[model samples]
Target: MKLLFKSTLVLFTTALLSQAFAKTTICYKKDWNSPATIEVEKLEGGECKGELSYRDMLKNGWFLKDIKIEKGKDGLNYIYTLTDKRVVEIDNATILKNEYKKLDYRPFAIKILNVTDETATINVGNLRVGQSGIVQHYYEDNKTLIVSNAYVTSSNETASTLKFFPFTDLKQNAIPTSNRKPVTGDVIIMNYMYDSSLIIAPSQDAFSATREKYKDNNFLHSDLFAAKLKSEGIPTPPKEVIQEYAISQNLGTIFFIIDNTIYVVDSKTFAILDKDIISYNYIENKRMPFYTRVEKIEKNIFTSMLDYKSWFGFLNKIFGDDTRSEDERLLENEIAAGELTVKGEVYNNYYETMLGIKK
Candidate 1:
């Protein structure tokens, strides 16, 4: 009995020590510059599964390159690894700070249409010619809407006003109805005015000049705009040409021009989330049932049309008639589909059916 008690006590103490000495492996990588070194420290009260703190790296101008946590083979340890080493630490905060000084003389404002318990409806105000507006901030803390001042302008209208009303009076009281939906955090809005009378031509120099002025603001002046132009199949401009034209303006909205039609981008990541293209065939004075068309031009890839209709009345109301073609009846049956195939592998039907791709 005495020997058995001693053995039990030793086992209990061993288990306690093992629990207290848990550790984990943390992996990290440096930026494009090879041989990048980083000093890491164990934070007090941190995870028993080894966790590395980069507080020192952040202070030394080193940002997070990439970090991912995974379960270890034994299931007791958590492995953290940095995947990408190309991400460089940029001084975005410094750039934004410097851009504030060169802000044009424009009083930034938003017309509060309504304020509710969970949301606020507001319209962006326009700036006068030669004046600019800035998006200082958009935040909600303790149920209060806070906006900042930022400005941009061109020689267009001398003045404009934004309307505001009580929240209870606006339509769709359940949901906020501003010009655009605000993300949960803050939705900063900036307005700019351009003189329509000015016959301005597109030029690289003009855009460059504007970019220089707002260098600190990180405004997507020309480089970003140029990419947008190409993605939409718009004609690309010369490399370094300047044009005398009114600066295009946005009312705190994403702007895109497709086939001479302008569009607004509203999401934080302004990438085309989803797109469907439809083609119509003019039949013998009468429309026929929409059929799915599939085409495989390369590899295990295929493209197809999934649906069509004579009139997309619902879409016309929101996107407006601009999306409509010249035909008297809107073609609602055209859609483009993409599919991929792998050699010696079964094709994944999941991708096609999930996005309504007929092929």
Candidate 2:
């Protein structure tokens, strides 16, 4: 019975968010004969063996997307209306073991409206985390309906408002390729991979002057950069990394801004990545977090490998002998141990000198 319970839990959760967001799907699918809630369902013997349901229409969906219920248009109980092209068939989905109040759900329509890259007309909704434990679209009042969305922290998402988008998937055609620069006070926001950083310099000399300060203490606010990124706004940003940009071993690229325009610099030549998209913003004028893409920086394996020549030069450079410091002793002990295990010509030459192995 417990096993059956577990299976049912897995069955529902797999049917909901994960299964739905896996692709663009129909929440309520109708076959030739019947109106089936599941997009695809296969019954095995007596029980329902497999099924795909209305949640399939979610395209790159979020866990708290389109599921929140506000006070209805009729102004009575709380309700959330489905838009076009998708439906949410919420039969039973297992959630994390917690005590947060979950929503009561029923099968909605197959109204899958593409939400990403959409700029909503009215500044009504704000994507916020509610007590219900999901990303919910919150409006100012009950009358205002959330018709569409683009992600942003602020409520009023006008042209001036700072918004968020995936840095990697931006529309390439929209960025301007001109060499124009913003005035000294204009703000240019950047999303490097997922991390958000803002550059607030308008001139080349000022920006270069700021960039040179990183060598001192690596502080963004110290003489180098303008200011740190605060979730609230510019200049006084909280001391934290908004998102972590993963460093690649072999791939290197730098995304930097000049005159409110971003340029992708190739690591190899440190030149503009694409001439056409040089100094560009999003086609829709949206700004993404800019990551400085370093070009192919050298990582020569021969220079890094552990060998006699390398060991000799490196040890001599660092003065790894005297055995006074803990670091020096560790290196000497490691080298001595390495020599004892080998019977080769390389080991023979260094064993006497490094380990005091007398002839």
Best by TM-score: 1
Runs of candidate 2 with Cα error greater than 4 angstroms are: 1-12, 16-136, 139-196, 199-242, 245-359
TM-score of every candidate: 0.20, 0.19
RMSD of each: 21.5, 23.6
Candidate 1 error regions (>4 Å): 1-141, 144-161, 164-201, 213-217, 236-359
